[model samples]
Target chain A: MTIGIVGAGALGLYYGALLQRAGHEVRFLLRRDFDAITRNGLRVTSPNGDFHLARVLGFRETHHMGQVDLVLVGLKTFANHHLPELVAPLLGPETRILTLQNGLGNEELLAANFDAARVLGGIAFLCSNRGEPGVVHHLDQGRIRLGEFTGGLSAYADSLAATFRQAGIPCEAVADLPKARWEKLVWNIPFNGLCALTGLTTDRLLALPATRDQVRAIMEEVITAANAQELSAPITTEFAARMITLTTAMGAYRPSMMIDRAEGRPLELEAIYALPLARAAEHGVAMTRVAMLHALLEAGEA
Target chain B: MTIGIVGAGALGLYYGALLQRAGHEVRFLLRRDFDAITRNGLRVTSPNGDFHLARVLGFRETHHMGQVDLVLVGLKTFANHHLPELVAPLLGPETRILTLQNGLGNEELLAANFDAARVLGGIAFLCSNRGEPGVVHHLDQGRIRLGEFTGGLSAYADSLAATFRQAGIPCEAVADLPKARWEKLVWNIPFNGLCALTGLTTDRLLALPATRDQVRAIMEEVITAANAQELSAPITTEFAARMITLTTAMGAYRPSMMIDRAEGRPLELEAIYALPLARAAEHGVAMTRVAMLHALLEAGEA
Candidate 1:
């Protein structure tokens, strides 16, 4: 299968490398890593095993990448302004677009702009970061729970999930997309917002009793909002504890937003915070902690 | 009456200089400005007028200053650990220890150590900072609302208010000290915490729509808790707007906590956040944003 990777940051580069190495023709739309990747090929250093892909297809423009079977978007939502133009030429009539961006509204944006039927949203539970130019570091967790933007499981979605599984990414095709997005937000809203806001990793945040209590409270707020959305399953209060336990096992892991802020980049606050806050307000649920965190993040932005 | 000033940072210095200029014998137990004040006297640069005390009384040790009728405390709450020793030498039979400190619990601590009837707590609305050695820059707002820790406006409290008014400081004697403290907290918890956390001053915080909304929300939460404590009057929601408007007029004013953070010193989180949060919890009110802000402040501690 021929695939076009848009917004080739850490996740794009890492996953694209894996897919390409698994015998799929994966073309990456590169920015900072363009020259390094095109010249030295893609290098992925992972806990699973280190692999170097020498015959890499890296592009600076979507027109150059042409059409492909699938278009995987990994753009920071802050940079979503460039999406419509970037993904325009990399489309065929039956081209499926999978967006693994964090938070809400990514799929809707893609669906509004391109083919709604071809749009699928993914929640990637992957811990990774970009190294020197061409290099990508996969620290841990690369499972994806994705579904159609319009909701439910389709054969095409199943086939896409199978493709990811073949590429060594544990993939699941879910019956509900918004539910999966909100579930992902249960973790993202607290850890990512907090770690970015406070410059503390997951472990350090949880180590301090005050912050640990805060994380739980914020998670419960998220759950309250999520459950109000009337999803297929209510994300139980127990889920907050499970998340805390899972995060404890991840050690002192920095969320991607934290790394982004460290590198002096704008946070993806619109999709991750503002949209979800709006949804909560629509459901007559006031996510006070989340809104406060969102405001602080915005106020701190340079 | 002879006055002994404890914790002579900014407020102590400014008010001490004013009292000394007004023909009162004001002895300041100084730290950073001890030598400069003792040798070169005290300089106060203020909007009301500029003034200098040529024959300023300064002491390095609290014991040297001895006991006086009044012991005005202007210490940062973070430095409250030094209170017992620093204040012990400056107490008389009826010292009337007025703590012009930020947040809650100052009166409690002082009352526990000294005579409970002699303890007074003042909610200072001053915006000022320490300058070069003996100099203090009085920016704006020197009005103080003070009362007895045991509740009600005592004769001592009224005399203290009259003394401050005579010394060119706006002063008011209130009946409910806790309510006054909590009312001050309605402003402090949001502005001080937000400014300290985001490095944004009052004007900048209110200029942004999201943060302005957050400030209102936090103030409302504080008001909810304050009302639950059975105050003489409920703080209306309109008071949040009034506070915001008042702060807006102050123009990019950095709260004391913000300055403390900027100077690489510890914040007065216990007085400003923790104690208030505890009281709110005890009253069965959840100050969610306030708690979250408190946690972020704690998590971001250097």
Candidate 2:
């Protein structure tokens, strides 16, 4: 399968390298890393194993990539405004677009530009970072939860998941996209937001009892919000506890939002925090903790 | 009048200078600033006027200072654990103690050490900072609200307020101490916490509409919590608006908590954020915004 990876950041490079290694033609749309990637290819250092692609196709402009069978968007959600123009040149009539961006409204943004049926939503459960210009570090967990934005399993999503699974990336297809987003949010909103706001790692946050309770409170608020939105994905107190345990086991991981903040980049506040908060507000679910965190992040950005 | 000024930071020095100028014998109990203050006296650069005392008394050890008519406690609330020993040397049977620190439970801490009847509460509505050792910059506003801890007017409180007023500091005596603390908190919890957490000054925070709304929301939460605790100081929506307008006029003032954080000093989280939050929780008022902010501040301190 020929695939085009947009926004060649850490996740884009990690997944593109794996897909390319799996015999799929994966082309990366580059920006600042264009020269480095084109000259040295992409190098991925993962706990699973290290792989270096010495020769790979890279493009500075989207128009040069032509059409592909699938377009995997790994851009920060803050850059989604450029999608209509960037993704236009790479889309065929049946070119399925899978957005692996963090937060709530990426698929909707893509669906507004491309076909709704071809716009798939995905949550990357991978701990990864771009170490250098063309190097990706996969710390742990390389799972992708994929689903249709409008709900239910799609043939394209299933096939893509199967391909990802074949590449040793545990990809799961879900029937409910909103539910999946909320479930991801149950973890994302608390961990990512707190890490960015406090500049603390996952282990540090879980180490303190007060902060641990705060994380649980934030997760419960997300679950209440999801239930209020009528999206049922078994998000419960037990699930929240499981998330805490899981993060505790992840050792000392710095979340993506924290990395964005550390690198002086704009946070994915609109998609990750504001969108879900607005939905929750519409359903009369007062996510005060999340709202305060969102406000602080927004203030910091300003 | 004999006055012993404990905690020779900005507020302590500013008030001490004014009291000395007003013909009261004011002695400062210092720590790191002991030598500078004793050698050079205390220099206050104020918008109102510049004044420097060349022969002020300073003591490194609390025991070196004899008992006085009044002991003005101006230490950061985080250092209140050493209050019993520090204030013991300066307290007589009727050496009325007035705590001029920020946040709730300060009067209670003083009351625990000294006589409950002699423990007075004060809210300093002054913008001041220690520019250097023995040097304080008085930016604006030198009014203080004075009240009794047990909640009523007393001769000691009245005389203290009169003394402060005579020293060119506008001091008002109030009947309800807890109400005064809550009223001050309606401003402190939001502005101080937000400024410290976001690293944004007053003007920047007020400049953005979203953050401005957040400030208001936080103030409202404090008001709710205050009302829940049965302390009614007329902290209404109108009062909150007045506070916002007042802060807007203050330009780009950095609250004390922000200054403490900038100087790498531990924040007074226990008194300022935790005590009030615990009280609100016991009263069944969910101060979720303040609680989250408190947690973030606590984490940052950790």
For all predictions in the order shown, the interface RMSD in Å is 1.1, 1.2
Q: What is candidate 2's fraction of native contacts?
A: 0.76
The complex in candidate 1 yields a DockQ of 0.76
Q: Write model 2 residue lDDT over B1-302, tens digit each, in one string.
A: 89999987889999999999999998888888888888888889998989889998998878988989988989998888888899999887778888999888888877776678888889988899887788999998888999988888888778788889899999989988888888889889999999998899999989988789899999999888888876644568888999999999999999999999998999989888999999999999988788888878888887
Docking class of 1: medium
lDDT minimum window of 10 residues, candidate 1 chain B = B293-302
Candidate No. with top DockQ: 1
Off by over 4 Å in 2: A230-234, B230-234
CA lDDT of B294 in candidate 2? 87
Model 2 alpha-carbon miss at residue A213, Å: 1.6
- What TM-score would candidate 2 get against the native? 0.96
Look at candidate 1 and give me any clashing residue pairs.
none
Compared with the true structure, the alpha-carbon lDDT of candidate 2 equals: 0.88
The runs of at least 3 residues in candidate 1 whose Cα sits more than 4 Å from the true structure, single-residue gaps closed, are none
